[model samples]
Target: MGKEFSSVPMYTESAEVTKSFDDDGRIKRTGTLLTASSHIITAVIGSGVLSLAWAIAQLGWVVGPAVLMAFSFITYYTSTLLADSYRCPGPVQGTRNYTYMDVVRSHLGGVKVQLCRLAQYGNLVGVTIGYTITASISMEAIKKSNCYHKHGHDAHCSEPAYPFMIIFAAIQIVLCQIPNFHELSWLSIVAAIMSFAYSSIGFGLSVAKVAGGGNNVRTTLTGTTVGVDLSGSDKVWRTFQAIGNIAFAYAYSTVLIEIQDTLKSKPSENKVMKKASFIGVTTTTIFYMLCGCVGYAAFGNDAPGNFLTGFGFYEPFWLIDFANIGIAVHLIGAYQVFAQPIFAFVEKSCQKRWPESKFINAEYMPFMGSHGFNMFRLVWRTIYVVVTAVLAMIFPFFNDILGLIGAASFYPLTVYFPIEMHIAQQKIPKYSFNWMWLKILSWSCLVVSLVAAAGSIQGLAVDVKTYKPFK
Candidate 1:
């Protein structure tokens, strides 16, 4: 008798398979769904949440929310447009897989790609430095306030304490190195809950203080009468600069590509992206409104400290303690997100330099060791912590460092990346531009990017010039 053959389907490379890895490289089944609310909550609640109120204070209550909302809309529109137009790279890869540079290279040629890469790298480094500074300062504030209370004045509490900072940085770095978004998703949720609680509590406290006949000196809105004196060209210039600053402050959609790649389903991913952005912006807008209303109402123009901190009637020690702890956690979360690209870039650079090193070998010295804890990550994190701690000690002023970092790092990532991606995607013949809107947005982005970059440079230069050794 002839051999009977049973019919069966054969699996092939082209067939869809379901498997995944988290940042820690633990394997899991694919097709998990992350909701829009969750994604938005995560995207919005980061280091910026604490600082946004302060940034708005410089403009006063009337202008702050307006600028924030407008900038948010512009950023949202641009980001969504870019996402829709560009062909984002595969899931497993990070943002480096198809950066703004890659898009430019595909459409605008290699030279532009190089330029974009340079810009991207500059932006990344600036952001890393900024986050580090924010994180270290936050930790220092917490340690000085809490640790000293728990310990004593004799306890070592100094800004140059790099070792402590390194430990915190390692925690952040490891959280970031987790290969999967599933684990990190919880971070956003926790941050959002804390942020909302803080903002609500802070706002209530500020309002109560104002209502109870606290110092509430109002400032005149007129330009000439006040020292602002924005008359003629100077007025126009300041407005332009303010707009640029606004754009820099609000443009945070640079992570869209990564967010898109992280999602398992295309439709869900797009929905989450939009939802996250909307939630983030809306939450921010509300917080700004509440803070501005109550803050300005209480402290007015002569607000004693940074407007955010100064608004409330609480004692300095109390406010600082709460802020310190909250900000520390938020900053650590941010560091995790930001560090992914930095580590990836380092790995890529190392691989390029030593082609025969077999550095990519899984069995080789892991970028982070097999277990989440290791010396390799510890060393890199220590370096990051030390550099930032040193900067904090030298600068000693949070507002200036924040502004410098905001302009240098956040501005480019938020403003430049979207526009560049938009322009790059325009090269596709089928893509059409809304001539009027495009022109306006393009000009706006260009002007804002230039101003922010210039401002950042000036701010950094001022820091350098004013530098004195910490006592």
Candidate 2:
């Protein structure tokens, strides 16, 4: 997360260094296909997936899974487009763009690059906020003694999200200091494992609940009452917000380049990335399907905003603790992975804007460099973590925030930009059938994502009117 592959001087003197598939010798390109897939899975599946039950709960059985799968397909296609879009038109490996904003600047010009920067930062910050909320909530669940039973029985608990959010932010203040995504490879793997563990445990709890004659399974489109009239504005709005939630759960496009950069150029980087996307999305989709379906079947309309929080069983309370702990752990890694790009962009900008600044060092800082202790790194990352923590404290609504982030960014980052960049880079004809279809597809995505974004705003407005901070 700290290193900049772009700044690595391309070694044209050595053919191997400039090997189309190799890193300009600056990056070792040590990752294999499996590692690449793991990173993709780690990037894609996060605490957000825990909310899928509630998300699909709004769309019902039919539409919910359909939308989830649709997003999986959409993201996979766009992410590959992004990977393929990384290289420039010529055979010169030196001309490649290594970051998302660089891709935009190369293909679409400065205006779009600026816009891309906005969306990328917005999405990254939004991810920090969302992960902060999840980690805090998970820790809170662990702290509440017998809180699992209380959660299931509608009893009150003393554990609040604020203190734990502060605690998690403290941890992020440490981890965010790591500079690059490649450096967090071990953490990413652990995050992926934790993601799977929580997912399996969640699904098991749901199955156990249903098997124990727990008649609480009550499905509903509005998420509260069964068969609510679709004509009502409130119900329709809720459904769209659900769409946002699903999209948010599936969003990993923002970090696609960072993930792809981890892989070696051998065996084709785009091919490896495509395989990684397929593996990650397929695995996540299966887990999501099981967890979402089983969790809904267990709690029906009564499922918690977080699917894991819904299961308050006393028989195996340790499982809840383990699952929640996994969530907290995974999110710590996730926060770093998503935060790296923004950190790099800002630091590079600082270097350019103040070339003569005392903090600007001419010597290259390798991954895990001693210079990581510098004032600039410490200050900016601390500020980033603190600001995100504050936001989480003020608005701790898990599902709603996901909707807002997804709505605001899903179209621009995940859908619109990738396809647009592909069309531009490939120079697809303006009036050709391929161009027409892609135009239709991209515009449709724009419209859908905008609608979802609106729904998120509406939900947030309502939350502002009624939400109790620290409650």
The lDDT of model 1 is 0.51
Per-model tally of clashing residue pairs: 8, 7
State the TM-score for model 2.
0.90
Clashing pairs in 1: 22-179, 22-180, 23-178, 23-179, 23-180, 24-178, 24-179, 40-276
| Candidate 1 structure quality by residue, lDDT tens digits, 377-409 | 345555664565565455554444444445554
lDDT of 2 by residue, 1-471 (tens): 354322333244454654343555454667777877777777778876888777777777777778888888888888888888766663135255678887788888968888998898889999889989988988887766366454654556666678899889998898877766767788888988988998898889889888998475678543544354344676677777888887888878888887777777667678788888889989998988998877777777656778776444444778888988988988888888888988888887887898666454333445664533455777888998999999899988788889888888889998889989888878899989989988888888888788888878888888889877766
Worst 10 residues of 1 by lDDT: 1-10
How far does residue 221 in candidate 2 sit from its true spot (Å)?
A: 8.2
lDDT for model 2, please.
0.78
Clashes of 1: 8
